[model samples]
Target: MDVEDDNSYETSTLQVLELKTGDSLRDAIGLLYEKNVFGAPIADVIDSATTSGNFLDPYIGFIDFATMVLWSLEIGELAKSFLWDPFFPVHLNDTLFHVLLLLSKHRIQFVPVIEQFSSKVIAFVTQNAVIQLLLQSSGLEWFDSIADKPLSEFRFENDEHAVHLYGDQSIAEAMHILWENRIGAVAVVRRETERLIGCVTRSDLHLLLDNDDIFNNRKSLTVEKFIHLEASKVHSDPTIEGDLGALLSAGILTLKNKFLPRMDSPVTNRRTDTLKQTMKNLAETNCSSSFIVDELQRLKGVVTLRDMIVQFAPPCMDSRINGGGFFDSALEQTGCHIEKGTLVSDH
Candidate 1:
């Protein structure tokens, strides 16, 4: 692959996924609502998607209702259909161009990848994955230049496995699965035939987090039941404009009704040594972040150089002008006196 040095490239070592970069998370959210991916208005999705009986912090938890949403308009309907095959799935062995084709067709960000023979879901080929793969493939000789170590010793690879949930499950039920597994996404399956309904992501939950109504509303509902109510219905009728209106009116809809790019393209990084090797992987693939998966193709977590900086370095050295207890200073600049950290709420 020819390495082009565009503005998106960082030090000839990394590339940022710029497709969605200039776009604001807020605007993307509004587009999702307008398009009806959540099956209701922003407020309704928030209300419908929240859990009722939980109190992580009482006051603090309530504010979770204001969390930012992350629904991508790029991944939509066909993405949802792929979600319905309990076993049939999009896989990772495909290519970047192929993945782009899937997204072009459906507008989904996360697509489930399955094993060929057993027809079992194994891994997810996220948009981020394709970009990272692109970046990783850019640096092929990093490992070959190193002595004796197998490339597999350091690089991350997809095991091609999946974590699943029933299509009839409630939002709260999905929440529990996500929380317990420390994962940000889940796959939904139907009740009778165990067909795939669709997949959900942390972005979806974040969108729901903005609604306060869900807390009081779901007190009596199970998560499985709640999600099932939203994801169970699938519409074969085609038309983004009309479908958007319906979903915006309700709380859930099928993935096929939305826009999702790329389905089952897998690209690989032939192993490399050192953190730079990782950076090379990211740059070649044009991904902002990449996952670290185990041999079983299950996700371990993600590793991004951005994350690396936040982890190892102190706040001041990172060139973040808003660093160095800046929020405290801004509050002080407002001339507010604090007797403790508590401010007197305005009556």
Candidate 2:
């Protein structure tokens, strides 16, 4: 039941996307691309095709575009199937600050909000959603103290070296960098002036699935050409091969429309912009990350959704033992396979 009070939130019904074990790499990518979602849970396969669980426990693990792209770029042709990563999940009783810490530390998109009694996942609260809740606190003293501060006032560890590529660089090369660096997007700059010209994000890579023309001519296509294609496409010289798998596959859910989630135009910020202001821009643009640039439009640093969420957490020392960044290393240390993704626990 929903609380009618203006301050309370309700655990309402939701339609969550699910990836199956049988979904090929391309199939999963196309699903995410089609849905315009960053990540989703893999549906559990069992004797009966009915949904099962504590409250509604039918999912095994979760996966996202960033990890999927990384896998496609490196671990090709293993028939390697993937699924659930045991990530930090939240209970109804858990405090917001606790959830914020887990999100900031794990750098995850959504934290599973499970029922306290049956442990069924009732919600997958997203970073953007949480940020929206915080934005509601704009007038509060505690929130204002942090939001009013400029970007320079906050600490950005390892932010100076944002991954980037030149306009002349091939789209293939950009994909390789995204795979190698474990990043979602890269800045495209003019080689001569090093000015921010455009941005090539993980979302842009979906062109390979949506447009057979792009997959056919990926080699000769430059980053600049790729960005241009987003606006008005011109196919490259036809080649023998086309897209890897059937771009359109029957998934648990149907695809929406062919609309790109992220755009080539770089949503940016400056050193002087306050946290409150930057958050507004990010929300307005529906962008996960923003490039901080100088007066000359040269890239200075980048601010991400994770960067914003972490800012709200109470000040503390880095507690990670092995420089815990992404879950890749953690999985390796535990000998976990692609199917058995990693999950973090606050305990």
Candidate 3:
């Protein structure tokens, strides 16, 4: 079904690694770690790598999370073989239900949108962006009404503006770009076409700040050395403790001791689970997001805290009144138990 002249794009593993397929993922991570990579997951890697040296003793409470970055899958492999295609990407200009349908069917976080003429990826639509759109569409502070109108009413329309850095730019240069722009994320662009090559997030810069890596001296550091010394790490797995408060408290403590910022970790749910089971996970984690992946471990779709708010709020059932960021307040007003490990309840 691919149009040879479509000029859109065919997935290329080589393009992904920024090199040939024969190269290892480890090598790719190492290379980029020396330069840049972004997004939430990669943030975890940069954190671990930069602080590995100082935070060595766990028992002494000097542990660091960035030290645990791990290259589970090779960059080349990830590029050539994604769960979904990048060329035929999800359009950001779509309805909520439609977005939901795509997420459910494709099981992806980001879908690359290619320009029809160039077939080059022009932009990306991610789950986070969609959630923001959903929240905006509701207009109600609480977004309690699940079945409202189509989501396109809240489609994204904005001038292109992004902080950017080049592929071979020094980490110090990346840091300067962020500081000057007063932004946390920067697009790593191809110098010639100004196309997005990758990203360098606040988390990536955090590594530089936390490590006190002097830009002047970094010249002696090779890409391999930087990645091996600062970028290699493994992702953290959230444990299911019977007590929600205990779990959160423990997680917070781990973050503090490890000098890693806390983030919403992934969670799983039984599709057939009771409403009670669903609420329990939501309360304990406060993230309001549960990724619905499949048996193959591919992304299904996402459920937000706001989605549940609409289902339970009484005001939402009555009429379409704007709640104005009142989902948390409404939850409390209704006497829903938000505290960790509390039984599900609605006043």
Best by lDDT: 2
| Residue 2, model 2: Cα distance from true site in angstroms | 12
lDDT of each: 0.35, 0.63, 0.36
**lDDT by residue for model 2 over 7-29, one digit each (tens)?**
22333356556677677778887
Ranking under TM-score, best-scoring first?
2, 3, 1
Error of 2 at 121 (Å): 4.5
Which candidate's TM-score is highest? 2
Superposed on all Cα atoms, model 1 deviates from the true structure by an RMSD in Å of: 20.3
What lDDT tens digits, residue by residue, belong to model 3 across residues 210-243? Answer: 4656434454443223333333333333233223
TM-score for all predictions?
0.28, 0.72, 0.30
Stretches of model 2 off by over 4 angstroms after superposition:
1-14, 21-27, 30-37, 43-58, 81-86, 91-93, 115-122, 232-262, 314-347
C-alpha RMSD by candidate, in order: 20.3, 11.2, 21.9
User: lDDT at 297 for candidate 3?
Assistant: 33
TM-score of 1: 0.28
